[model samples]
Every structure is written in structure tokens, then in C-alpha cells.
Target: MRPLAILGDNITTDHLSPSNAILASSAAGEYLTKMGVPEEDFNSYATHRGDHLTAQRATFANPKLFNEMVKENGQIKQGSLARIEPEGKVTRMWEAIETYMNRKQPLIVIAGADYGQGSSRDWAAKGVRLAGVEAIVAEGFERIHRTNLVGMGVLPLEFKPGVNRHSLALDGTELFDVVGEIKPGADLALVVTRQNGEKLDVAVTCRLDTADEVHVYQAGGVLQRFAQDFLAQ
Candidate 1:
């Protein structure tokens, strides 16, 4: 079980992950360096997919690192900070996920309303999936971004009306425990426990709306799902 890593309401994909065109020699660059990717061609964080170095570099390469970033040591800081582990230093977000992706760790993200509300970029989903994010639980979601998550084999969940992160007291520091199989409109319990020993249980509804979504997710992605279906027939 991984902590849900909650965020405040109205977090767009651009905020969830960095989107600008410029890539600085920050945490993302450091990961790129480890992966042998030159810092000059780092490009946007979006372009790093299929390459570990680029993705890790861009994890914190956001030119405009949101002020909402909550550091691992329980301190939220502006801009990117290097996540230091026994494996050396890596971008914070990527560092959290690198452990999981390589070891096949199960992960989840918790957020407030309007999650994934931004450009309908597939990389938004790809990034999290590559990082081993199995699911996202938020107060709400944008239509396209939700689909994008499903397309990438990541689950998107919504908090019930009148129930939100505020009431749950989630501060992006709690480890979340999600139960049940992914199904359209399925009910699941999000178990969150804070560092101070506080516990929060949030009710969530699965956002995948169609059987087609299940197919895409089960096949690991839209293209793979399509290819399988096309080849079968």
C-alpha cells in the first residue's frame, strides 16, 4: 500500500506534472544525467517518455514548480528539490516512483477537485503510469483527463459530494490503502493515515464510465487495447 499523496482541489495536469517548454538543470536533469541523457536536449517533461533519464529529469524540471509541492520531510517548498535516497539523488516525484516502478510497487495519488483538468495530453497519464501510479483519488475530475488516465491503465476515482480532502484531513503525507477491483461506479474505501497517527477514511467512486474503458485498462493502454481488438478480428 502506497500513500495517496493528496493535493488540493483544482490541480490540473499541468500542475500534477510540469508542462513548460524549458528544461533546467534541476532534479530532472540529474536523473537524465544518471541515464546518460544530455541536459541540453531535455526538452519538455512530456518528451521524456520511454526514456528513464528524461522522465526522471523532468519530474522536477517544471520551470514553474507549483507552490503546493509538499516535500517528503513534511516541508512544502517552491521549485524542485532533489529527493535523496540510498540510491543517491533523484527528483522527488520520480524518486518516490522509481522505487515502485523498478520493484513493481503499488501506488496511488490523492487530490482535491478538478483533478487532471488541463490540456488533454496523454503524457499526463503516461508519466504517472510509468512511475507506477495505480490509481488517483480526487474530489472531482475533468472529462478528458479522466479518459486519459483510463487510457493509460491508471484508475481515476472521485470523492463523494460533500465529502472531500478537507474533511478527511489529507495533507499529501498519508499512505493510502484502496480496496476492491476497478469497475465503473464501484464503491471503494480510501484508508489514509497521517504521520501524526491520524486516520481518515474517504469514500470514492470509480470514474471509468464504459466497458470500453475496462478493455483499454486491462490491455494496458488504448493503443495496445486497439491493437489486440483489431488483430483478433
Candidate 2:
């Protein structure tokens, strides 16, 4: 899977799904305008989240986002921005997600310690899963958010001690594959293939943490697991 976004420590739910005013220039705001909604009526994302069209655009919509993949003069560029791989085009986070979605590409996010550390919001997990993020490999995770990710069928893998995105020198120009079986706290291999064809196998700890969580994740999330059981009954 490709790295959709490489983020740093303390990436809160607010960063994943912003609750602030939607500016007219944002992807969600632009979408609302196309739908003929008056700029004055363009509400906060939290208010219009029931509409997937608007909500999906809010993924990584925080203006304060600092995406490592997006850089300007060797400094990490801030804002809700991302770099489309291979092409290396830097665009708003939603535009990049839209492009990958249209391509039907599976994505992954690489993050630092305390990833998803804030108010527990379902939208934080839902938004990434909807964007085709199959997994997230981070230095560490917030407890509630980690469970939420499992509920959404997104694998949460933790780096082994002293191993992190920075140590690996990941510049978002690489592809990743999860090698080996997954189970609670199992060591899984994260196969990193650089743009120049170099490969490295790094071990990551599966954060499933419980047999029940594994069952739910393997069944493709909470709703799917419920449906499967219901039909079986």
C-alpha cells in the first residue's frame, strides 16, 4: 500500500476530522458551493457529517496539518496538504484522497507516537477507512482510537522500540506491504520498498490486542461482523 499521509505525534481526532468553520476555499466548502449552498450557510463539518460527500472531504482537513510528504525548500510544509506519489504532485489533502479513490488504490498512513490522541470521534476512523486506508503503522496509538480503528477494519501496527518513521527515513516515495499473519500483539513484518528498488523488512507489533478485536477486524469491521452473525442465526 502507498503512504497516503505521513504524520507526526499527537495527531488528534480534530486533525483527522476538523470541527472548525469550513472556509470557502476548502474541499468541503467548494463541494458545498457546487451544490448551490450559500457561502453563509456553509456550516462546520461536524454539523454536515451525515452527508458522506461532505464528510469525506473533511478527512485530514485541518489547516494546521503538517504532512511530511509535502515540503518547501527542505522544510515540511504545513496545512492540509499531501503529495501524490510517483507524480509527486502536492495538493490539498481531499484532492489527493479523491485522486487515489478514483484510481481504486488502497492507502496506508504512517504516523508518530500518540497518534489519534484527543476526543474519541468515530469520524476519525471512519474518514480514513472510507478513503481506502487499509492500515496504519505508527510509533504508538491512543487506546480508544486504536480500538476504533479495529472497529473500522483498519489494522493498527505499532513500531518496535526505537523504530519510527524518522528512523526509517521514509519520504513518502515508498511502497509498503504487511508480511506475515496477524494476531493480537503479533510481530508482523513491514516490507518497505523504496522508489529506487531498495527493500527493508521492519518488524511491527500488531495492536489487535484481543481475540475479539481480531475477529471483528477479520470480519471487516463491526457492522459486517454483526451482519455475518445475524445471517448465520
Candidate 3:
């Protein structure tokens, strides 16, 4: 898997799925306009989130997002922006997701401490899973959001203490592979292959935390697990 977006500490659910007004030029706004919704009728993202089409566009849609891969003159460019690897094309976050979806690419997010902070938003986890994010490796995670991610079937891996994206010098330019049997609190290897053909294996702790969470994840999420249990009864 490749890094879809490299982020820092304190990334909140609001940043993952902004509740603020959607601008006319944003991916969600343009989609609404195409569906013939009047510009004035384009409601806040929180209101339209029942529709996955609109809500998915809100993934990483926060205007204050500072995606580390999106840089200008050595400074991180702030906005809902992302860089498409190999091609290195910078585009709106939703558009990048569209491109990856079109390519059928599996993605991963590399982040720092306190990932998924703030009010618990289900869509924050749902959106990334729908975007084909298979795993997230972070320095740490907020308790509730970590559970949310597991419920959504997105693997949450925590970095060993004192080790992080910065220490590894991950610039969202490398390919990553998670190697090891996954279980609650299991230590796994994150194999990072660099552009120069160099490889590094870093240790990460799987954050499933409970046997039930492992079962839910293995079933492809909470809802799927529930359906399976009901059918087997």
C-alpha cells in the first residue's frame, strides 16, 4: 500500500470530515451543483452526510488541512489537497480519491500522535474505508476513534514509542507493506520500500485491543459480523 496522505498529530474527526460550509469550488459543492442543487441550498457537510456520495467528498475536506505531501517551496501547503504518487500530481483531496478509486489502488495513511481526535464521527472512518484505505499507521490514536476504525474494518497500527513518521523520514513517497499475523495487541512489521529501492522494517502494534474487535475486523466490520452471526443462528 502507498501513503494516500501523510499527516501530523491531533488530526480530528472534524479535519477528517469537516462540518463547516462547503464552498462552491469544493468537490462536494460541485457534485451538488451537478445534481442541480442551488448554490444557496448547498448545506453544511454535517447535514448532507446521510448521502455517501456527498459525505465521501468531505473526507479530509477541511480547508485547514495541511497534508504534508502538498508542499510549495518547502512549506507544507494547507487545504484539502493531496499528492498522487509516481505522477506526483497535486489535486483536491476528493479528486485524488477518485483517481485512486479509478486505478483500483489500495491506500494507507501515515500519521503522527493523537490521530482521530475530537467528536466521534462515524463517517470519518467510513469515508477512508470507502476510499480504499486498508490500514492506518500512527504514533497514537484517540480511544474512541480507534474503536470506530476497527468497527469500520480499517486496521489501526500504532508506532512504537519514540518512533514516528518524522524519525523514519516518510514523505508519502514510499510503498508500505504490513507483515505479520494480526491479533489483539500483536506486534507487526511495517515494511517501507523507498523510491531508491531501499527497504526498512519498522515495528508497529496492532490496536485491535480485544478478541471481539479482531473477530469484527476479520468479518469485515461490525455490521458484517452482526449479519453473519444472525445468519448462523
Candidate 4:
């Protein structure tokens, strides 16, 4: 892949996607706290995203609520690296996604094993796709998340065993090239090229393991494919 953006090693899908409990808290805690979501019944972050008031708050508020290995004001950094509006608010991954979405910038996520391993929810892929992620690359994958990605029409790629982001220094800016038609178990080439002109060529497997998957991805998503078929009849 030419112009491939690289990312660091050991990123899981959960790290890429927020958990329901955390998502619930992140979704509602901000505004609700001010309007009084009642700390007791504030609910999980995943539960209240349907409510814009809660979702907006949770989106930004969450970067301050979780432990992302770095702490400020007693809150760990959780979201993406954001320039945080107002000149200085907490910056986190979710907030970064929120910012990128607002800017209409296309995104790509890179990670390592058990990627997308925890849950089987379609929201995991939908959330990222909605946030404008065009594709994802990882060292390995969890079965369900891999399918969910294809179902959402997001590309899921697995790096060959011996090569990963660590060796490539992928950090979300390197562009990737997935050359050749993607097919199940086919060895696809991922050419990672840094902005400064350094490059690393690696081989990865196409996560879409079936003919049906290729069809689904080509059609945009499972639901879209289904709708198209339904309309055809």
C-alpha cells in the first residue's frame, strides 16, 4: 500500500472502540452532570448515545473520565489526541473522533492482536465508520470483529505474523496501500510509507473470508446489500 499511515503496536478493537459501560458514561456524563443525570442513574455510556444531549457530553466528557495511562486533573486520557477546543479541555480518543467527524476528515485505525476481540456488536464497526474511518490494519483479529468490519463495509486487514506496527513504526500518519484484489486468505500487500519517504512493505491477509463478504463490502454494508436485494424483487 502506497501512502499507508502506520500506527503503534498492541492496539485492540476495544481500544479502537469504546466499551458500552464506558461509552455510556462518556455519552451522558458531561451534559447530564450539569443538567443532573443523577450520578446514580446516569447509566452506561453506550446506553444514552441515542440522546443527543447525553451523547455530546459523553463524547467530550469521556476523555477526562477514563484512565488512558496519563492523568491530568485526576482524569486519565481516554480519547484520541485532540487539540481540545476552548484552547484547553481534556483531549482523548473519542473526542478526536468527534473532531475528525466534524471536520469531515477520513480516518484510518491501526492495531495489534485480539483486535476487535471482546464483543460481537455491529456498533463497534458502525461507530468507527460513522466517524469516517476508511480502513483498519492489525497483526491479527478476532473472528466476530473481522466480520463486523466487512459487514460495515470497512476494510479489515491482518499483518503477517512476523511483521507489525512495532517494526514499521506505524503511528496513524503513514499511508497504506492494499494492492491487488482482496480475497479470503489471499496474501495482500500493505505498503507502508512514511510522510518523510521511508517505506516498509508487508504482507497481510484479507479478513473478508467469503464471497458473500466481498459482495457485502462492495454493496456498502449488510443492510444496504439486503435492501438492494429486496428492492430488486
Report every candidate's CA lDDT. Answer: 0.67, 0.94, 0.94, 0.61
Error of 3 at 151 (Å): 0.6
What shift in Å separates residue 213 of candidate 1 from its native position after superposition? 1.2
Give the per-residue lDDT digits (tens) of candidate 1, residues 77-135. Answer: 55544332233333555555666567765777767778878777666677777767788
- For model 3, state the Cα shift of residue 61 in Å: 0.4
User: How do the residues 1-233 of candidate 4 rate in per-residue lDDT, one tens digit apiece?
Assistant: 21112334444444444444533344345457677556777666567656644444332232322322234575534444443322334445456656666766666666666766665655567666766677787787778778888888988888787876677654444556678686776788877777677877788888888989988988988999999899999
Over 1-233, each residue of candidate 2 has an lDDT whose tens digit, in order, gives 99999999999999999888989999999999999999999979899878989988899999999999999999999899999988999998988998999999889999999999999988999999999999999999999999999999999999998999999999999999999888899999999999999999999999999999999999999999999999999
Residue runs of model 3 more than 4 Å from their true location after superposition:
none
Query: For each predicted model, how many residue pairs clash, with residues at least 3 apart or on different chains?
Result: 3, 0, 0, 30
Query: Compared to the true structure, candidate 3 yields what TM-score?
Result: 0.98
Weakest 10 consecutive residues, lDDT, candidate 1? 81-90
What TM-score goes with each of the models? 0.76, 0.98, 0.98, 0.72
